[model samples]
Target chain A: MQVFELIIGKLLPYATLVILIVGLLYRLNRWQRAAVGNIALYPSAATRWRLFGKVLSEVTLFSSFRQENQALWKRTWPFHVSLFLILLGHTRLITDWPLRVGLGLSEGTVNAISAWGGGICGVVALMTCLLLLARRFGIQRVREISTGEDYGVLILLLFILLTGNAMRFFTHYDIAEIQQYFRTLFSTAPTQVPHDPLVLLHFLMVQLLLIYFPFGKFLHVPGVFYSKTLLAKDY
Target chain B: MEGHVQVNETELQTVIDQVKAIKNGPRVLQLYMDICAHCGVCAEQCHVARTMPESRTNPAARSDHIRQLYKRYGSTWGQVLKAIGAARDITEDEVAVWQRDFYECSGCRRCAKFCPFGIDNSILTRKGRAVVHALGKSPFMMSETQRISDETGNDEGQTYAAFVEACRFLCEEVKDDWDIDVEIPIDRKGADILFIPASADLVSFPETHMGVAVFFKALEIHDGTTWTMASTAFDGANFGLFTGDDPHMARKNQAAYDACIDLGVKKLVIGECGHAYRIAKRMGPTASHFGNPFETTNIFLLADEYLQKGVLKFDKRKVDEIITYHDPCNFARSTNVFEEPRRLLSAMTDNFVEMTPNRTENWCCGGGGGLAVMDGAEKVEMIDGTFLDYRMKVGKMKVDQIMATGANYCAAPCANCKRQLMQLMEHYETGVKIGGVFDILGNAIVLEETKVKAGAKVAS
Candidate 1:
């Protein structure tokens, strides 16, 4: 178990970084090629700005959401909102000053916030998974378009969020130790990593998400914003 | 009629065989099959939805109705599960409604602009219409219109002599109104422009035709000619556009071009009909029916150029009422002549306000794409009234816009749009007078001796 943990712990971040960068660039290149012939004539800067505004509104606020299917929107809104909070909660991993200045909370309070955010994200993610699965299996229109990759992506996301919540709330992993290890890796210290099974499991699950994100429909997380702006509207 | 009722099985087989043998038939069919997301944006944008609120006969609904056929074909597992013995049958009732529903649409393509997946419902509607035509189950209105076009040269049964007389009457009206003895020359060789007004404009909507005559007289450009072909080709309103009869469309277009070739005119200036303009500008030049490329200038473009170059001057005082312009779908969306008409309107009247979703996103007038001429009273619930719901919504939206400005007039260049606008205004009790853009311009034209004010405002 130690050997397995050591190998995975060292290799995961590098793999994730590579997948995120290379996959995004490759997909964008393919999209650009496909879109070149279909460009609208006489596009203006104002139109571009309006499209950007619409994308921002759709992603951040779900402004197009109405009361027609409140149940679907309820599940979707919580999933997206919790995911955003969890992402924001992880800012300490990127930069310490943001958490120190912006959050202005004690270490315990920050850690507690992270744990609660992760738990909420995990619950919403599971609900989203169930809803999406139900939609794929239940609705004829959705089922007709859905492929194996869609199911795979949803299952993978659910697994990641569930593992993250487990590591945060149940196992009570050492947050300081995990942060120190990452900080050392960034600073090129190459110290011997501490043995924490939940942390190791969390890192592995994140690596799996990164590896799968590029090739699957999870690409739509970013893709929808681009398509909404570029294809649908006159912009 | 009894002898001609024989089924041409060979012809039917040929069409079916051709349809099946198309290079991307499976792909196109699958694209049409799989591409509906049903966001209802199309229904919201459709004029039919607004006009016929109770029935909800929008393009999106029409597409869904057609897709039920594919669903019946067992394309999906769920559909296959639902397909029992009697459920799979395509009934005569289904064919009848499809014929009625399909003919009621004007094929405006406005629904495509607002569709989330960019699935063109109009194309699917056309395909359905084509299938109906193949089955020899086309609506009587479509068949009768096709017959008229095939026999007479125009959809209206006006002969060559009557067409010339109509032109003479328009000239006489111009003489009476403007005191200008304008010669609306017919069959004149080497004329610069060949004016082809829609048969509706010549008959029921003479004011639109008179507006064109008055504008011509004011411009003093005596180099235009009209054809004497009052038969099927002269109508310019192609009913085949609504019915999706390509062969019939080809025949109608060929006759018009043949007349133009025989007359030896320099340019074919198709008059104030949206579909006619689209046909002349886009379809006629490329199609095999027109038989080789002939140089033609769109009359809309010509009018714009002449007005811009100071060749035509209009008095703002004559058209001193608040007005708004409704961009016809064919002229505004299909072709790119939105700005030209707006510029002319702005020059003619200071009170010209644009309707909501103007220019490329403008609503259809509900009469375009052959809906105006389809005279089936049985399908009136589906076609004109229900089909125009979205247009009525758009018209109501326009009415609100006009009311806010207190505009007394609404100007549209297309004769069909003008007709529909009149109906919409009357139905809503808006009391707004509808006229062609040139009609307002004809009223506003400044004589050469008149004093010009640089920026004088005309009060309502």
Candidate 2:
């Protein structure tokens, strides 16, 4: 188990990073290389600046999603927003220079802020994820369209959130030690991983997610930009 | 599944090969096939899904026919992804479903507006239709129109002599009905504008054709710029778009482009047919990047320019009925021509009311994607229930929208839209008069100079 933890902590991260980067680059290259037809939906932005603004609003605010399905948007918008915050909050596990020290906050304040703010975002993301999963199961139309991967993605996020929240609320770890572990891991050296099972589980799940990211619907992050530009650009 | 076409093993192999080709085809399509989250937001937005209430009618559900094939043949790793419920092999039954369901979508693209990913299922629908068309499994009406368009350069099968006779007849009709002496010029060399409307407008909605003739006459009188209809390529409606036949679409587009160069027209002004305008402006060889000799403009943009310039005189008092515009899918969504028609309608009628969701968000008129031209079981070879029945059923949303507006007339400018809405109104007994925007324009256009022109023609 210690060896397993060591590999998860020290070795697999490099593989995960390499695979994630190369896989994403390969995916982007494929999309870029494919022939594009003139199929843009009209009444789109006429100028590049407006087109950028339109695509930006769509990505940042889910503007088009809000226009029609406000109910789904209510849950999906918060779920995405909270997920983004949680991802940003994960800098705590790495170096806190940007999220904490950049803000000139003390370690005590950062920890307290992390416990409250991160706790809130984690809870929001968890609740929205549950609601979205329920929607998949409950709504017949949604169920009809959904595949196993759809269910698997939501459930994967559920496990990730549950493990993450368990660590945030149930246990306390030394920030310096976790950051040092990431530092040593990044430097190609062996280091002590956090002994918490939830930490290990969360780390393993996140790595698995990153490995799978470029291969699946998680590419929606990059894809939304390409599709919005493709579909909505007028001139 | 009843009465569906069956493919032999060789044909099935051919289909699989084609699906593999599509799986490798366009970036937009490849990304769309890969990244759809199956969120079902598109189902709610689809008029066919709402009215039909079937899983197959759902946008994503219909698109899944292609996605399943794409997964199996798209990549080497696709097999591994199948374990996660992402990939599947193409099957005969799925191909049969493709024939029925892909045609059912009007390709209105309303679903794209609500899709969080902006995934246009219409593109997928076209791909599916292309596969079916390759197998020669397109519905009887779709394939017939394509053949007719290919043979006669127009879907209506109107011969060139018949086209010339129709133009002469329309000139007399304009004189008798509106008391205006307007010349419907044919193949006039060095004309500034070349007008190509749906050929159906010549037979089915001649008033729209008449309205354009008058509008052109007014343009000539206003700026000495003239327009002519080519005897060789007067029809703008191309079923190639409907059947996803790229070669046929390009061939039909070449006919129109050749006419422009032959007549030496500076601009090609497409009449009120929606898909035709979209093709001429964007999809065809006339697309801007091709750098064709002539510019393309629509009737609404031209007429709206005149209205904005205060050059054309419209007697709003002539149009007494309450009128609302039905935004044709290709016009409103595909080509962004919603506002120009509405602006003209507002000037032409005092009682112009709007349907609840007008413009780009408007409901499809149930007859888009060449469904307007297709009547189910019209020919012996047609399988499944009649498309006429299907159109009426899916058009319920549009009928409801028109009824809610309480308008006496619904001015839908596209030839396909006019035919569909007229049939739909008749089917639903909605008591709504359906016609083109130019039909209303023809009704209200006051020809102050036309009376003198009529006298001069009489004197001559």
Candidate 3:
């Protein structure tokens, strides 16, 4: 158990951070190298600001999908939004007290957010992620494109979410111990880790996921920014 | 499959190399390959996808056929990963399917309209066609047209004497039919505008040539403009766009450039061939050998400008029928000449109506991407069925659009659109009279009061 904690809770986090950065750089470099000239699409100069507004709105609103298919945007929009909420909830780990003071919220308000709001966010993410995974199996047209790699990537994400929710709802974690442990892992100095089985398992899943990020469908996250129309100047 | 393409291993390597070395397309090519969510939004926009069940005209499927190749061979990691089912390999029999699918696309770019990312699969399809062409495996008709253009400098292989004879014959027809003595000046130096239209216009659709002559006559009196057609480089349609052969496109464009230099014209005007207009105005300047030093304008845009400035007068009653315009894919989407044609249409008729989705969002006539000249009306490639049937199937959506408009006349400006559209009207018995936009211009142009004095001034 200690050895598993040492590997997942202590060493793998930093190793995966290096892997994540290097993997991202390698994939980004491949894209840069493969990109032809300015094969982008945009409206005329009169509405050039629309392009920026469009990319921003698409990430936030899924307006493009709405225009094409109403039902699709319904599922896809919430899936992405829930993922975002879960990410925001995780900011609680890095520095909650400082952010709480900055926002002028009381400790009781912070505790309610940490316990209730974060729980709701995780559950929503869990539901949306499961539905999104099930979607590939539900539709035949989508199934044609869904590879083992695509499913494998999603399965990994689902595991990360499952372990995260386990820690969030069932397993009790020491907040100060966990915060100090992350600070150690991120900083030059190394220290002992919070050894909750669910927390360690969640951390290990995320570490493996980070290492495998660029080799699979996860590239689509960064890829949306480089989508053809987003970079285009004319139709 | 016949004369040129038996693609050996070395030839395969060269063709694949050309695809991997895409310098002209954007960096979004990678994004295009990766970003498709397979939402299939573009399927409805594609006329083929709507009409043909056998072809699987789904834009994503069409894109994937090429993207599969890019994924399989585009990179080393892709090649290695493909073995373990990360991506799949494109097999030999699939090459035939790839060629057919690429050719079947019509390269309309309508799919890009619905694509959330603006991933124009036509761009990728053209690249696919380019690689196929590099392997000498483009559709036989496309390669034949390019060869004719290469050897004889025009689509028909119309010799210098034959071209002169045709021009003189058309001039006689104009004088007899319209009672207007119009001479198609050939190789006239220092003309203000050089007109280069598709060569097939002279013989197949003489009315279009007659229309241009009348429009030019009005322009002569009103705008004081002088124009001439070069005998050697008269055809404007570059088969390079269809076959996806860039060198051929550049070389053919150079022929027109040489003609412009030979005439020393102030501007170059592309006649009503949509793809040709796109090539000359958009790609020709840079793809051209001698740089474009003067202005390049679509004839419709120029005519609209003349009409707006009161330089040309049209007797609207002469074109009295209810008119609806078929926006050529190249003109409407790629080149931005849609408004000018509509503006000119309004000038010539009171009954001009817009089809449900007009302009950039318009449906293609299925004759685009060099398909019209394939003339499925006569021949189908390797398929067992008739090519005319193939054309009709793809053209079914366009036929529906025009039929819904209930317009008696469709002014299809591009010759390619006109040919395929004429077939649609005939097969469907839609009773829609299809002609060039200039055909309407010729019918309604008031030339009795017009004189050639503008030409005399420009000549001086």
Candidate 4:
């Protein structure tokens, strides 16, 4: 158990990082090479520069879906926004002064910000993922179009977020210790790794998500740039 | 499922290979293939999907049929994946149904408007059509038109003599009716503009030809802007774009391109036909096998330029009926020529109203993407074992929109939209008349010189 924990806790994060960087680069390169036709959705080059602005609004706000399917976007936007906040909440691991005191924030203020932001977003994200999963199962139109991949992705994200919130709110997991472990991860070798069973499970789930990121529906993150409609609208 | 129609195994393999084949693939195709989330949001915006929300009618659902085949056979790894049951197999039933669904979709990219990612499923539909075309299974109307286009450089198999005779008749009719002696110049050398109308305009829709004579001669008499009809390569319609085959499309467009070069015209203007202007402007420059020497623009742009310069005039009193514009999907969403025709219509009519969702969001006149030519109710039987006039049934949304406007005339600029609108009006018994923008212009355009400023401001 110790050896397994050490390897998964210490070594697997590095492997996941390599797989993420190399896999994303390789898949993105393939997409960039294959984008040959001009399939611009809009008819004119007159409003071409507005393409990125349009993409930004949709990506950050789910604006298009908001206009069309308010039910879906209601759950989808909060989920994405919460995910973004969770990522911002994680900067304590890499920042020089944990919780970004480089911006001249006080220690007490940083702790309060992290507690409220991470706790609230984590709970909201988990709830929305559940709602998304429920909709995928219940909605006929969504069910007809969705494959097993869609269900699996949502369930997997649910588990990841649930375990993360568990660590944040339920147990007394040492924040400084986890931060130190991640600090070691940024170096050539990691030491004093947290082999806690929940942390190990969380890390393994993350590794799986990372490995599938470039190959799955998440490829949309990279694929949006190759849109013909975007090119027609902008270029 | 038990199959009634026999599946050709060999032909099925050829179809699958083409779907999997990507040649110098524009990254747009691959990205679209890879990235679609199968979200049903695009379905709401699709006229077909909105009307028919069955299993495969959804835009994303329809596209997935082709995407599944491509992914199943894309590479050795994919083949291995298929063998182990990791991915779905490309079956004969899917291929057969895809044939019907892909053809039914008019290749209107309107679904892109509601797609958060802007994934244009029309490109995928075109790819499917190209594969079916390779197997010699394209729709009968499309393939027949392409065959005639390839042999005679026009869809109607028309000759120069017949074209000239038609024009002469139109010139005489214009003089008899309106006392305007506008000449329809045929094969005149060194003309400034090479005007190519759909060949049917000469024989079937001669009013269109009469209108062209009126408008072109007015431009000639007023501004000395020379425009002539080339005796050969006279048709502007390209059925090749409908088939999704590049070589075939190039063949359809070859006549007009060669005519522009042969006639020594300074400007190449594709007259009011929608798909013709789309092909000439969007796909013609690079995809036509040969290149156009001059940049090709639709007549709308030229008309706008002339309208703004105070070179075109209209007597609003003459066009006394209420006019509403129907935007052809190709012009509204595929090419940007929506406002020019409306601008002209406004100049000529005092009672101009807009359809609910005009411009890019305009409803397709069910007869687009060569469906106007298809007339396939006799040939195809629906799954319910009933024969239906496919255009009128699919075009119900647009029919309602047109009737709601309650306009006397619909100023449809594209030939396909005009054809479809006429059928929709007849089928719905809506008492609406559909004609080209120039048809309205011919009725109301004043030949006298003094009213330029009045027409220009009214054009706003």
Candidate 5:
């Protein structure tokens, strides 16, 4: 309990910090939506379905990766795959109720999967970040077009993953304490939160990422799905 | 030696110098120079580029050849250094290849329509041809056609006797077929419309010419006249539009306009050549020699207006055969004459199946731009390479749609489209016949109130 209280001392401020950052992201999305309303020329149900299918194929399945320049595709596919897997691994942090209800697994089993997924994601993320950064600076056309924002996104993502995996794999943190902190925030209960420094660092980095995502082409993660799929030539 | 004129070097050089002086005369050239992005999207969209072997898929390869001249003359030192670094140079052999390539294109705006930036590649091709023309390097066929246009007022060099004889023959044929004494008036003053078609229609595409004559006869309207101009401008087929010489372009248009004005016709109805119509309707007004406020309504627009007002009627029972319409790239994309043709087709036929990429998105028949008239074996490489491939791919898709419907006829208004579609049909052996929109209309024209002449039969 004392250890939990100490962890909460460091992490509570970041909860407020995450709230503020998420608020900014919401505002940015709202602003963009207002700015570019109804820009699609041919909006229809069939078009929507086509666009949805295309986005799923492109972003999740990396359908376009197959047709893209081969060397670039190889580096990009692994990075994207790792990032998605890492995101899925983090679902346990948000809601343990799903694991409790669906799997009926003990906390130990859930923790093992999370840790394994997190570690694999971290290794792939670091390697991808390194290779992509090298290629962006090395390739003539890519180098010419890449901005400071591009490098910043790559570096920040690397930091988040590195810190996340280090805390999960290297340090022994109480999963119940982390889950209880999340449950308190969700339920509006003023419970004491985790105070682990590595957890606090991870939360801070994630909040910063949320604040940054809307402002940069990182928004293109969603934007490309809409543009490429929705606007693709029908015939 | 028979119909060809000998090229005088000194005179040709003088003409070239004169053209070079006026090359930068128009704001159009400035607009062209500033607007193009060189994204090669035009080349990518171009059927010629797609169908051409990897060795020659770049349509802009010729334009790039001419771009060297622009870089040499128009660019700053930094630009020159960049061009030099890129190994760009204008040489005689390069010039010769450009001449062949420039002529090989049908000047269809299929590429222009698909370009994200709207870079008017056909216009640039024309401009390049103009530069080549200035250098006395015009292709022999085009130059000969231009010469015939200059001397005989038409490309075919048809005399007034032949012109009248053809008209009379058509009138007699109409009288024999339709049982009507429809007079095709010549040299009548204050006619509502002065109908000027390419001489090709009178001789080669008789069915289309007869369609026009039938259209006029069925309306029982006599306010139109056809004339063979006293000078070389009788044919509206502007070879200069293809070759890119503005003065020669101006000369051809000026002659046509002068004849129209001389006849005191209120409106000039140009026949179904896409570039010819574009030149007459758009470029003619801009050429300084035409003296601005140049007035002409495309014949297609006239047809549309008439059809809308119930001035024209057709018996759809006559056209029971399944048909599809190919929008000539010029009329479809360039001039926005898409809906009217379809409207006409719908009225004329019961089974009008639209090709997949119909209207603005329709593919070129691989023979527009100026490739239709260009005489060279290398043209096969351009057509079979780019135009044919584009048409075939798009055409195969269209052909499949067409085959699914089991349509026997494909109706295209533009002569170039008809010509190209004919070749495609032959190449693919698609077992489909191609003709003009009015050919269908003429076949379907039912004389209800108007009495047919006792002995008249439809002219073939």
Candidate 6:
């Protein structure tokens, strides 16, 4: 148990972080090295700024997806938006941003907001993940095109969300201990990790997701920028 | 099976190697192959998938063939992921399926519009076709037309003398039919504009050719904007684009550029062909050759400019039937030519109506990517269906869209669209008159000297 904790709770975090960054850089470099000609769709953005704005809107809003399929958009837009907001909320794990703590709220007030807001986001993400999984299985056309990797990724996300929600609603975590652990890990110091099994499992799963990202469909997150820019930029 | 090519292990290995090398090729294609989420948004938007409803016809499934081969052979991670069924080795049967499924796609790019990653399946489709073409397994008609173009400088195999004679004969026919003396200037040096159209327009749809000649004559009388057709590079339709032969496309476009330079024209005008214009304007060397010495513009843009300037007048009542425009995939989506054709149509007829989904989102006429020029398998050992029957089957959606508009006339400006649509109308017995947007221009344009004749026709 001690060895498992040392590996998952200590060593793997740094190892996976390096792997994540290097893998992403390798993939991005591959994409950049390939030759891309002027294969723009017609009536593309007229200027560089407009093209930037267009790609930005597409990344944030999934505007093209909304225009084509409203039904799928209703589920996916919220899935992405909530996931983004949840990621922002998770900044509390490392250090509180001035925007949150600068409000001068009492610790009790801050804790209440974090509990409620974090819980709601967890629930939304969990529900959307299940719904997306159902969609992959339920829709015949989607099912036809889907491979094992598609289902495997969704199942992994489901477990991560499940562990996260369990930690949020059922299990207890020490915020100060978790913060100290992350601070020491970031600073390259000897670390003491929070010993809660659920917290460790969730962290390990997130690390796995990050490690697997560049090798799988999760590349869609960054690949969208290149794909959209190539298709939508005028020049 | 009837038209499938026989290949051995060596040929199959060659195709797999070519696909593997594609990873080192175009970034758009590489990125798309890497990033597709298999979300099936494209299947919902694809006309062929909607009509056919087969796994092979689905855009994602079709692109997956190449993606699978790519994953198996291209990357280290992909090879590791092979245990999870993410990738696999290529098979002889899979190559046969690749030949069919890749050719089955029209390369319209509608699927690209709605994809979450904006993955253009058409690019993958073209890549797949390119590899198959490397194997000498392209459809018979597609390969044959390219051969003819290579030999005769036109897909129709019309020689230089025959081209000049055809132009002269068409002028005489216009004089006899419409009582207009419009000359089709050929190989004329120092002209300000060089007009190149699909060679099919000169013979199959002669009226579209006549309309351009009259419109150019009007331009000449209006402001001395002289335009001439080049005997050396008269045909603008390129089968290389359809068959995914880059060398062939570049060679064909070089002829057009040489013609422009030899004539010393200020502008190169492409008439009524969408893919040709797309290749000339952006895709091929004409877009960047010698710093783009001559400007490339479409005929409708020039015509609409003149009409807006009041240099050309139209007798709107001359075109009596209700009209709807078919936006060729290459024009509407590939070249941004959606509005000019509609504007010209509005000027020519008060009864113009739009199909349900017009412009960039419009469905293909079921004959994009050079499928219209190919009727079926014309030679043995070719890997394709009886494509005329295939076109008719997939073209049912377009026939329905036109019928829903209840328009008697459809102005499809591209040569491929016209051929496929005309056959669709006849095959479905829809009684719709399929012609070019300029075909209406010929019927309705009131030339300065021909106003009396135009008024008489309107009166009658």
DockQ of each: 0.05, 0.79, 0.40, 0.56, 0.02, 0.80
How does the DockQ of candidate 2 come out?
Answer: 0.79
Off by over 4 Å in 6: A101-106, A186-188, B1-7, B288-290, B378-385, B450-460
Question: Chain B alone, TM-score of each model?
Answer: 0.80, 0.95, 0.91, 0.91, 0.81, 0.94
- Name the DockQ score for candidate 3: 0.40
User: What DockQ would you assign to candidate 1?
Assistant: 0.05
Q: Point out the higher-scoring one by DockQ: 1 or 2.
A: 2
Query: After superposing candidate 3, which stretches have Cα over 4 Å from the reference?
Result: A30-50, A95-135, A166-175, A229-231, B1-26, B54-56, B286-291, B375-386, B447-460
Model 2: per-residue Cα lDDT over B279-396, one tens digit each:
9999888776788888988888888998899987889889999998888989889988878888888888889999989888898988888888888664423236798888888899
Candidate 2 CAPRI level:
medium
Best by TM-score: 2
Give the alpha-carbon lDDT of every model: 0.61, 0.86, 0.75, 0.75, 0.60, 0.86
Q: What is the TM-score of chain A alone in each candidate?
A: 0.81, 0.94, 0.87, 0.90, 0.75, 0.93
Summarize candidate 5's per-residue lDDT along B1-460 as a digit string, tens digits. Answer: 7537444566434433433333344333333332332324455455566555342435544444444344344444324333333224344244455565676555665654443332345665777677667766775667778888888778788988888888788767665765545555676666656677777777767677777767766554423233222233446777776777667788887777777777676667777666677667666642323544335766678778878877677878777778887777767665557777788888887788877766766767666655555434433222344434444443344455455656789887776667667767776898998887766766777654534442133223
Q: Write the per-residue lDDT of candidate 6 for residues B1-460, one digit (tens) a residue.
A: 8659454788778877888887788788878778988888998888889888878788999998888878888887767777766787777576667778887899999988888898999998898888878878787888988999999999999988899899999888777877777788888999999999999999899889988988887787777688899999999999889989999999999999999999999999999999999999887777743477889888988998998898878998688999999999998888889888888899888999999888888999899998887776644233446888778888998999999998999999999999999999999998999999877887788888645454335324
For model 4, the stretches where C-alpha displacement exceeds 4 angstroms are A43-51, A97-99, A186-188, A233-235, B1-7, B75-87, B285-293, B377-388, B449-460
**TM-scores vs. true structure, each candidate:** 0.64, 0.96, 0.89, 0.92, 0.59, 0.96
Q: Candidate 3's residue-wise lDDT over A108-131, tens digit each? A: 787787788778777877787787
Candidate numbers sorted by TM-score from highest down: 2, 6, 4, 3, 1, 5
**Alpha carbon lDDT of residue B291, candidate 3?**
53
Using DockQ as the yardstick, the better of models 1 and 5 is: 1
Candidate maximizing DockQ? 6
Model 2 lDDT vs. the true structure?
0.86
- lDDT for position B284 in model 2: 87
> Model 5 segments beyond 4 Å from truth?
A1-235, B1-40, B78-80, B83-87, B221-234, B285-295, B378-405, B448-460
